[model samples]
Target: MVTLIIATIPACELALSDVFASLPDIEIEAERIVKGEENAAMPLLWVRGVEPDDFEAACEADPTIDDLELLADFDEELLYRMQWFDRIGLLFQMLTNANATILEAVGESETWHLRLLYPSREHLSKTKTFCSEHGLSFSIDAIRNMDRDPSGRYGLTSIQYNALITAVDAGYFDVPREVTLDELAAEMNLSHQALSECLRRGTHVLIEDTVLIGAAEFNL
Candidate 1:
């Protein structure tokens, strides 16, 4: 059975770590690959917690980013069409691998997390070898057979699951709100924006599985 692997890579090992470090307050989610070819891709990004102007300025100053164009703006988030000019070989290598499929990728501050589907353990082993040869730090966060987790019944990704559980235990969701996002993030060793994204996505998954799925089953 194909395995779903969730892994984290240090931003320092990636080409865009500096760009992410520069905008420490912003959260970036890869929405989709708008276009892709060998060694290059144009991805639509969802950015939050930064002003549009500030994001533009930061991009202009960051050497890793070739260009960024605002596609849409919302009160709390912005969509960007970004072009990465160089140093994308790692991603290209992953994409070109015949045994894996990249499902989700999000970056915040000093780490990039990716969810990938690998055809077998041998494929994953080869990927790890590839990363090691390239001096990239790769750590697997979770792994499950894709056939067994079609509905994500095990909950959110490991990081998100743990974050949400810790937050709840710490009273983050309580009416009085005992824990601040920053405090919780500190406990998890994650940036505030990253923690926020984790909580948001975790809650969404919980609701979808428990409430939405339940409602649909009964024709509610």
Candidate 2:
């Protein structure tokens, strides 16, 4: 189970729900197996290209924009290599191949951050060195060092699940806005106490299915 989180925490959190929902919902028959347990291995590696100006233009352009294909292709290659190790988790990289053909088109000059998830530290380390040797000048941000909250159980009862969906729809629990529990309950037309238990359960499912297993299946 591995996932990569780039961007700020709040932005990452918002992106999580959106990203997970985009994945097909069909269930797989595999059981959850904790890999690299007790080894304190980091599962993610972030790589960012130095061409800041070009990276921003790529982000703003449509995904189908022809000019951005090269940068997108490079990112796909990184993802491909990571998956080859069976240790690859998630990847987010910044590059210089987008619609900003002119320098003036680059606004605010945003930096790109990519988070790559690997199955083990060994795999991550090897990939890191590979990038550095290639003159990529990328940095590594290990997952083990990040503060991942021990998520409480979420996704239990159907009512609770609905409440979570309601919150998500309203963007209530969004960390950026800090949706209050009371407010979420009201929005769901349920009592706050009842909603709280449901939220706890729903969160657990989200963490397990989306955060852990989602990254494990990439570019496959």
Candidate 3:
């Protein structure tokens, strides 16, 4: 069966990393490819991040960036449409060459984290080899089989797995709720809101995988 893999690619090997290095104070929260392949010109990207004015200036001055336009503005982050001149072709090659599907990608301070689905382990091996051959730094952070998990059903992401296990161990789901949300959040070293969101999403996945799916199978 196909496996789900979460990988991290160092900023040093990515074109966006150069942009981020130039604007060290700015952080990118999310990114989406708006149009065209990664290698093509005028590839539109929708980006959300802090310091809109600085971001604009940095992109304009950066050699890697071809052009940029402001799409929207908000209190926390601004949205941008950007075009890249070069240095992104390798990423497209990595995905297409491996025949992998990207589930999600997020950029942080030093790296671009990606969740991908590969046909099999052999395909993943080939992709890693391709990266090494091309001087791209690729590291697999986590992997799980979609067909089976320790819970005996749908696989949970590393974060979701940890959140659910921690909640149970800390007695967050106890009859009287042995642990407060704040206490649980502190124990996990996460903000209360973040912890709550993780648990909510984890519980939803667990229920869907174990209870809902099982019930449906039994009926059929």
Candidate 4:
């Protein structure tokens, strides 16, 4: 059975550690990371609680971050395409060796919370062992089998699933758009950006699971 692994690692142990330290109050969330060759990938980052000038300057000064380009600028958030050139072993292992899918990756202050989906329990163990041998400080917080988890089967966390469901029920997807993200987030008691991320990730998972080969796996 497929397994979902919840783990935590200090930002210093992962990529962009300096950026996190420089912007201690900033919240960084990965949005659909694209894996590329030569241990480099451009990840869409949703950075919150910092001005564009400060964030860019910090990234420029950080040796780990290679490049950054602004994608969007919200009231209190900025989206950017970022490339980290060093300290990405854990991320590379999760994506390549473990063959895991990153469902959610959020970084705050000094710690990073990761949600990964592996093909089997053994795969997760191997990944864990690799981390231990390399002294990456990767710590497992929880594990769940897809068959046993209500929302795991669809490759989404409980919170992501709930956000998607609530949005649908509130007609957030109606033809004319009955509800805005802010209103829906207020109703759900989640921040505007939080709800937006949940909805985006949840919808992506839903499409990948139901519209793609995922439907064939379950015969829906």
Best by TM-score: 4
RMSD of 3: 10.7
Q: How many backbone clashes does candidate 1 have?
A: 0
Per-prediction TM-score to the true structure, in the order listed: 0.65, 0.27, 0.62, 0.69
lDDT-better candidate, 1 vs 2: 1
Point out the worst 10-residue segment of candidate 1 by lDDT: 211-220
C-alpha lDDT values of all predictions: 0.71, 0.34, 0.65, 0.79
Q: Rank candidates by lDDT, best first.
A: 4, 1, 3, 2
Residue 214 alpha-carbon offset, candidate 1, angstroms: 25
Instruction: Choose the strongest candidate by lDDT.
Output: 4
Query: For residues 1-220, could you state the per-residue lDDT of candidate 4 as single tens digits?
Result: 8886667889887877787888889988888777776777668999998999998998998876776899999878889998876777778888888899988788887788777789999889878898888887987766657776477677688888788888889999999899999999999899999999988878876775544421212211
lDDT of 1 by residue, 176-218 (tens): 9998999988888999999998888777766743443211111
Query: lDDT of candidate 3 vs native?
Result: 0.65
The lDDT, on a scale of 0 to 1, for candidate 2 is 0.34
Better of 2 and 4 by lDDT: 4
Q: What CA root-mean-square deviation does each model show from the true structure?
A: 12.5, 17.1, 10.7, 10.4
lDDT of 3 by residue, 1-220 (tens): 6766767777666557666777665555445543355454343343555577767766776665665787777767777666655666556664666677765566667677766678777778878887878888887766666654443234555666787898899898999999999998898899999989988876776664444421111100
- Model 4, stretches more than 4 Å misplaced? 148-220
